[model samples]
Target: MAIDPKSFEAIADLAYRESGLQLVVEKASMIQSRLRHRLKAVGTDSFASYAELVCSDEGLDERRQMISALTTNVSHFFRESHHFELLGQKILPGLIDKLRAGRRFRVWSAGCSNGQEAYSIAMTMLETFPEMAKMDVKILATDIDPKVVSFGRSAVYPERLTTGIPKNLKDKYFSVQKGKEGDEYTASEALKSLVVFKELNLLSNWPMKQKMDVVFCRNVVIYFDADTQDRLWPRFHSLLNSDGHLFLGHSERISEPSNAGFINNGPTSYRPIVAKR
Candidate 1:
């Protein structure tokens, strides 16, 4: 069944309002085409009927699948290379110097998709902060999607996932296997064990016991509307330590004003205004 442009606009509007994904108007044809595939499974040809299934139908199982397909999850090891570089050079060293006597570092990877980014953070810490690894250099990586969280927590990956990863680091942190194509790679247990993965819905109230040293939210808030982003900032502010750092995606910078209790380290880097005693 072909989904007409009118139906595409209708559903896209509903989805954006419901999820705040801000799907561009250009995605109409793509949405129409993807929804059409699901229609094939249900043996339907009417766009009106398909919209109903997506709207208030009993197909929660299938609807989640649709959301995953339409949502972009393009990520990789060492993506937006500069952010991780900043983590290595500026963030980690400064944190260590501050907490060297305490010998502790706690970081959070918010919106950690498929685990590559989270694991990359772990790898960076292991390489840089090995001396204090015995302490509490823990990383809490969270994502809303359960299925991908499971995949990420498993710490397994295909060989292609290691494309930009350095050979020395790869050898030390990942083990190659004979997967379906006779070659596959998985993150080493030693490195994978350093991370703790959990299910998190960023929209609702959070239950964090402690503030963080750094928060790598990256590209997530871009999908949300201004109100959603506005709501999210305070939550992150509360979750981060008074002097903690926040790292946003290169494409998305902080929108809230300075008096909101955040100070800019640079364009993409932000720090919390220290709490007075």
Candidate 2:
């Protein structure tokens, strides 16, 4: 049976309240389209019954699967290209010139949906820092959805995934796969080896044992409420090294009180006062 609009929106609201996901009222149609496939898979029809199943503790795994389907994970190579450019130009040179001898550089890619963003950074590093190949450069890529994280770790993408990736890079890094029905250019093992993907929820315990140098958290925090953002920013700031940088989504900028004592390094970039010193 086709679900009524009211029940669908109500369930979306439920997900929003419980999970901190903010699907706009207009996205109700998309939620229906996506979740309905899961409905068919489970041989369930009514949205209320499905919502009940999702809300049940015994149905936790089923609920996670539903989230995987309903949430859109549309990502591509070199998203917000300027950030990488800034990294190569402004950040890397400085770090190399003024680093503790043989120091390791650590990076964190939060909401690293399918690994494109993470690998893109790793690719830039490999291209820029050939001399430092012996130096440690670890990129910890994480996202809330395990299904997508595992998929990303596979480093496979259809042609659409490379739309934002540069032509020169496509020739050098990825190999073409004609027979695959998904993304045309799969991330080569050379690039995939540089990134480590993990299932992480930004709202919960981070489990990261060390601080990071650069943090890429684009296109994510919009899902969080103000209070949640308020809480998470300080945690991110704390987790960063004194001289580390935090990159927000293009549309997601941090403000004072929530992000006080941070320098306005660039439009989409910020550095804690501790870093500026």
Candidate 3:
């Protein structure tokens, strides 16, 4: 049965309030379609009932499930080649110097769907700075959806999904696993060891204590409103070390870069302005 307009609006509003994800009128049909499985899972015959349950005190977990269903998990290895290039060629060298000087290095892969982005960073770092495998280097990969976090922790993907991965990196960091369904590639232990996967909501309090050298939040803030985006810019700036980098999606920009204490260093890339002594 088609969802009533009232139920759709209520659910949309709830989604926005809870997750800061804007679901406009155009997305009503998409929302209904995605929530159908949740309806079945929750034993609801209609969207109205589902919406009521989601809004109730007892439905907190169901609300999380709803958000998980609504989130998009599309990602691939080396999805943005230029970002990795910048990391390997420009960013890693400076970080390597810090590492040699006895400082720890950290990279955060925010909204890292299914581990590809984090693994890609790991491969790049391991390939460029082989000595890092023995140093205090770690990549923190986080997503709001628990399922995707679990998927990332598994570090496994279908063979077709590995297309964007270069042959050299593929051979070096992944091993083939023959499954009944088809061929699957699992990230090597070396690559997996460098990453820690966690479930985190951007709207919630961040539990990380250490500052990051690089933060990849690409394609995430595009789902948020201008106000939410503006609020996040300063938070990210605070999370970074001196001269730390922030990378956004191709279509996303840090409105008022100077106000956010960031300088547009490259396309969709921002670096925090170093404070003068």
Q: Which predicted model would earn the best lDDT?
A: 3
List candidate 1 stretches off by more than 4 Å: 5-10, 41-43, 97-104, 131-133, 275-277
Q: Write the per-residue lDDT of candidate 1 for residues 1-277, one digit (tens) a residue.
A: 5667666766777566544567666766777766677777767888777667767767565555556556566678888777678788887887776557775678888889888888888888878777655666788888766777898888878877666788898898888888887677888766776789987767655677888888999898888878878877777888888778888898877776475679888768888888678
**lDDT per residue, candidate 2, 223-264, as tens digits?**
777776777788888888878889988888776733555676
Local distance difference test values of all predictions, in order: 0.76, 0.79, 0.90
Q: Which candidate comes out best when scored by TM-score?
A: 3
Candidate 2: count of backbone clashes, pairs at least 3 residues apart or interchain:
6
Residue 13 CA displacement from its true place in model 3, Å: 1.5
Query: Per-residue lDDT of 40-129 in model 3, one digit per residue for the tens?
Result: 998979888898999999999999999999999888988878999999999989767779888888999999988899999999898888
**Cα lDDT, model 2, residue 82:** 85
* Residue-level lDDT for 215 in candidate 3: 99
